[model samples]
Target: MNHRGVEFTVAKTAIPGIWQWQFRIGEETKTGKTETKIDLLAIRRVQLRIDRELKAIGQRTGPEPESGGMVAGENA
Candidate 1:
């Protein structure tokens, strides 16, 4: 399943009210769990996490340029 360019999978666990969500991006895989079975909620949770990971790896998802931009700690 693809949501806003992010591909993920949601499956039921052995325990009730617990669902596992897994996202696959390139060679990396991210997984998480939620108490609700709503796919939208699960997708949102995964999206936020993926965004954070992307930003950490210097790959931001937006119109902002990757290079020639002011960094967070640089003195202007």
Candidate 2:
């Protein structure tokens, strides 16, 4: 289930200062029909997990790749 091209949002939870990020990627079924729903809590958890994993990988790999400097005569 790729979430690309879908709409999503990030919001703060009602409890104090907790944060929650939500994503809606529609849905799918074996019969070719889908019923989309908003599982805000679940989406938030998924985002947190992904963030943790990415951070771990970045730490192990020593920062992400950077873009090279532009050429002297390059047009903008």
Candidate 3:
């Protein structure tokens, strides 16, 4: 799934009822596990996490860049 300017995936782990998810940003990547069997729930959790990260840097909390000067992380 793609959200908050990054493409990520949620997959079932070998554990009885755990899901693994990950997403990558420039020069950074994050991964985590959720104890939910539902794929959409896992995706939503990751989206919330991404929102937290973007909010920390004053970046727009959404996918796709706005019509402006530069993107979130870029050489300017």
Candidate 4:
């Protein structure tokens, strides 16, 4: 399933009520298992997880400099 540019898949594990989900963004792949029987809820959970990860990824990379000048925290 695809939501907000994120694509993921959900499958039921052998343990019964466990749902496994995985998604890929750029070169990063994330996977997890949740204790939910509903597919919709699984998707929603993955979407929320995606949102949080994307935010964290953005924060980690930060923004690029426009003028090719010295980057932040760089020594002269």
Q: Best lDDT goes to which candidate? A: 4
Candidate no. 2 TM-score: 0.35
- Which sections of candidate 3 miss by over 4 Å? 59-76
**Cα-based TM-score, every candidate:** 0.56, 0.35, 0.69, 0.74
Q: Which ten residues in a row have the lowest lDDT in candidate 2?
A: 28-37
lDDT of 2 at 64: 56
Model 2 stretches with alpha carbons more than 4 Å out: 1-38, 64-76
Evaluate residue 3 in candidate 2 and report its C-alpha lDDT on the 0 to 100 scale: 37
Top model by TM-score, which number?
A: 4
lDDT of 4 by residue, 1-76 (tens): 8877988898999987799999999998999999987878887888899999888888999986689788789999
Clashes of each: 0, 0, 0, 0
lDDT of 1 by residue, 1-76 (tens): 7765767787778987677888876688888888866757766777777777766656544565579878899999
- Candidate 1 lDDT trough over 10 residues, lowest sum: 56-65
Which stretch of 10 consecutive residues in model 4 shows the poorest summed lDDT? 63-72
Q: What tens digits encode model 3's per-residue C-alpha lDDT throughout 1-76?
A: 8886788888999996699889887778998899986777878899998888767656554555569778668987
RMSD of each: 5.7, 12.7, 9.1, 4.8
Residue pairs with backbone atoms closer than 3 Å in model 4 (clashes)? none
